[model samples]
Target: MGVKALLSKPLAAYVHKKDRSWIENPVEAQQAVFKSIVRKAQATRFGRDHGFSAISSHADFVQAVPVRDYEGLSSYFNRVKQGEKDVLWPGKPLYLAKTSGTTSGTKYIPITSDSISNHINGARNALLAYVHETGNSAFLDGKLIFLSGSPELEEIGGIKTGRLSGIANHHVPGYLRTNQLPSYQTNCIEDWETKLDQIIEETIDQNMTLISGIPPWVQMYFDKLMRQTGKPIKDIFPNFQLFVYGGVNFEPYRKKLFESIGKEVDSIELFPASEGFFAYQNQQQDKGLLLLLNDGIFYEFIPVEEYFKENPTRLTIGEVEPGVNYALVISSNAGLWSYSIGDTVKFTSIKPYKVVVSGRIKHFISAFGEHVIGEEVEKAMQRTMAKFPTVELIEFTVAPHVSQDKGASFHEWLVEFSREPQNLEAFTDELDQQLQKLNSYYYDLISGNILQRLKITGLPRGTFRDYMKSQGKLGGQNKVPRLSNDRKLADGLLGVAKL
Candidate 1:
């Protein structure tokens, strides 16, 4: 066995032992997690007002706390942002993760020390899970390039404020730092195009063994490396073994990403938000990520079909069944209480509580009653790409085209392509066919003549990169919304294309 593998055996064994019962008794594991969080936050005002002192069961906690979106808790968050002490958590937050918002402009999410620990430990445990299952840790001996945001953070109300990835950059363990690249200077450049240029200059010849990032940004890096070296990613980093990705669904990018690498490599998917790192892929055979019951986040699920109704039912982990989509609600160490982070997920397994993210709650296309979701669009695009092997997608978004002067109202696609298709008309036809097969409502709309066939608007290359650059969201943990119901983001992309 390799020396790296031999050294990791004990740590891997410990992770397995700790996680065994979580898989064996998911309900109990989650209940323990809830109870711990309640006790931890019980002294806070939110807990007091919500009767956490008298809370003995999940039912009582539910009765005491009302379901809340970010807007519902904005008042408390305002206070926290103003440097109020013990407004939510027991102490002041260490940082505020600034995430993109629609009309609100930006959202400042509190990040406590405990929350940071949750993120760091969650990533470490995920790695340990990989080691335990695959019995391979040779990647540890070489550089693991994390395509993260700048390390330089801005101060807001005496707390550091930045993207989650940038905040995390400061906490990479010293031992791991020895094998991490690019240099601190390159990572802190602030401009993504410049940062990418610096990263290429610094690490192109390094002994890179693992890489992790949001898929699109990482793809950009891969493309740059390929052009610079005139080689596939595998040729440039011969020891590369793993790709860890999150922030968006990987299915649409999987084929292109592998093509860039020129070979299949082990990959681990993660589900993390600004609030907390929630879940990670734990086993190779399981397609869904294992819901992290013991992480500092207590989870609740509101059935998506009922979420908009009056007095909607909220289910705890024990009450949730497999195969139903639920809007995820979380109460975390970060001081968020009964907060809906806007993501929807479907449980694939209840025994281990594994789930796949279905889509975002706000990001769906129902302009014509088709109610198409991000997953459906992504699956359709994936199928379309499979049929057209030469087409390389850079980025895309779908929006409703409701203008009457446009002949017929339909879904409009704004796509930036790295490689042009052999036949664009054939590609559109295949995409439409795939959509009809995936969503019955969409199929009905097409067949019933209620909506026109989807329109494809090919965008020039670098369109998305330019748009993100303009928005100052050009790096790690930031992602373009894949599907929006209206034309707001679509118009923005069009403007950038014009530029």
Candidate 2:
């Protein structure tokens, strides 16, 4: 074994052991994190305003602070952005993670010095967990690339501000600096297409062993590599053994990705966001990501069904149960209090608290009484795709289609197929059947004649890409919603469908 690989084994073991120390004591770890952040921020403006000093328990904390999305918390954020110290957390934020918001134009989430470790360490531990389990650290000696945003930073209120991925770039560990690929200059290229091209040029012949990114962007990279070399990614980088990804579920893209790779490779799924790094897949056999309990963040779960109610029941880590879908809320060291990141998750294992992100709270199709989520749609597509081995899907989205001319309404699935199924009608039928099996509400709607069977509209090869480009969200953590309730996206897509 190489020197780096030899050293990595013990390091991975140490990290894994330390992780288990907290993982085994979930409740205690979470309670400690909760109290620590609360006590530390007690003197800050937000803390004082929310009665943090008088708070003693979860109930007190809940009463003092209401769960707020970016819009609801904008006032406090505005103060911080305007150079107001101690407005949210103590003094000033180390950096502001700038993310695209739906209702709000742009959101600047605080990343404090104390909280930055949660993001950094979470990523490191994911890799360590893999190394410790499989005893395969040879990849550490080869080049590793994270297909992320520009590393360049702009200033806002004297705090470095950029996309979460970009902010993370500044903190890449010194040990892996040489192994990290796509030169700093290439990474800072701003335009995703240009950056991607440059990345391919730089690492096309390098010893690439690990590739990381959101699935869609990574798929784009693989597609370009195939065009250039006429070979699968495995042939291009024979040593490439790990695929680390986050932002979206990988199942929908799995077939296409594996085809591009030419073989199955061990992969890690991470649940990361601008708000905080919440979880990482710790074991190869498990689909559930191990939620970070002691990581300077206290988690809360509101049953997804109760999310829209006047006052949803907020359950702490200890109170959450396996199989129940919940809207994830967090009070983090990053100065976010009772913040709703909008993502929903269902716990798969509670022994060590592992969760699978179900969908976003707002990203669902409920035009009728049938509320179908991203997970359901993705799962349905996965099952349908399995039966049709020849079919290759590039991307897809689901939106409700309401008829105006006395016609029955139905869910319209906008799909971009790389390879058209032999029988498109059968494919659509299978997809619809899978969805009905997954979602009871959708099944009822279809059975009761409230809605017709779902319809599929094949979009042009680059329709979604063009749409994202038009919206100025072509890359870097941006993803097309899997499901939406309204016709706004559907109408916009229809306008660009070119059918």
Candidate 3:
């Protein structure tokens, strides 16, 4: 083993041992984090306004602060952007994570000095957790590629501003910097395709052992690699043993990724966002991600069914139950108070608080009250794929198709397949049946004849890629929405889908 790998083993074990302290005392750790952040921010403008000084408990917190999305918090964020100190957190934020918002045009999420560690350490410890468990630190010896946004930043009110991934690039540990690729200059290229091409050129012959990115984009890289070399990724990067990914669920892309790799390799799933680094897959055998409790954030969970209701109940760490879908809310040291990051999660285990990202609160098909979520659709697709081993999917999305002539409505699945099932109708039927089994509301709607059975529209290969390219979201944490309530994305997709 090289010096880095030799050092990493003991360090990973130490980190894992320290993490057990927080993981074993979930509620206590959360309570401590809640008190610390709230007390620290008590003198800030937002704290003063929200009665943070007088708050004593979770109930007091609920009374003092209301849940808000980025739009609702814009007034305070505006002040921060214009260089207002102590408006949200104490003094100025270290960085502003700029992201494209749906209803709101652009969003600037604060990242304070105290909170940046959550993002940085959360990713580091995920690897450590894997290393400690499996005694595999050999990847530390080879090149590790993080397919991310440009490391370049533009200043907003003197605070560094960029995409979260780009911002993270600035903080990679000095020890690992030597092993990280592609070159900083190549990473700074503005266009994703250009950057990807540069990345391939730079690292095609390197001793790459770890590759990290959102699944679809990583798939794109793998496809490009195979096209260029006419070989699977395993042959090109024989030492590559780890695939670290976040943003989107991996199952839909799992089969394709493994096929491209030519073999199975260990992988890590992370739940990271501009708001905070929330969770990571700690155990290779487990599907759920270990939620970070002692990080600089206090978490709340609102039952997703009641998310749109007035005065929705917000439950703390101690109150959340396993298997319940909840809209994740957080108050972090970054100055966000009861902020809804729009993600919905279901706890698979509460002992150590392991959760699976179920769906986005807004990313669901509820046009007919069926309320099918991203998780349901993905699971259904997974089941269908399992049933038909020959079937190979590139990407897919679900949208409601309401008949213009007052006929029955149905869920339309836009799918891009690399290898179509021998019986496409049978495949569609299996997918629909799996969805109905997972979602009772959808089952009821189908059974009541209010909605017809789901229909599958075969999209030509690269259709989704072309669509993302047109939208200028071709790579770097961008994901095609799995479900949409309306037909905007569906209509746009159908135009180029060639029927």
Q: Estimated TM-score per prediction?
A: 0.95, 0.98, 0.98
- Distance from true position, residue 261, model 1, in Å? 1.3
lDDT of 3 by residue, 369-428 (tens): 888999999999999999999999899999999976443899999999999999998998
- TM-score of model 3 (CA atoms): 0.98
The CA lDDT at 269 in model 1 is 92
- Candidate 3 regions with alpha-carbon error over 4 angstroms: 404-407
- Assess the local accuracy of residue 282 in candidate 3 as a C-alpha lDDT between 0 and 100: 91
Tens digit per residue, CA lDDT, model 2, 195-270: 8999999999999999999999999999999999999999999999999999998898898999999999999999
Candidate 1: minimum summed lDDT over ten consecutive residues — where? 1-10
Error of 1 at 108 (Å): 1.9
Query: Tens digits of per-residue lDDT for model 1 on 310-367?
Result: 6779888889989888999998888888888899999998877899999988899998
Question: Higher TM-score: candidate 1 or 2?
Answer: 2
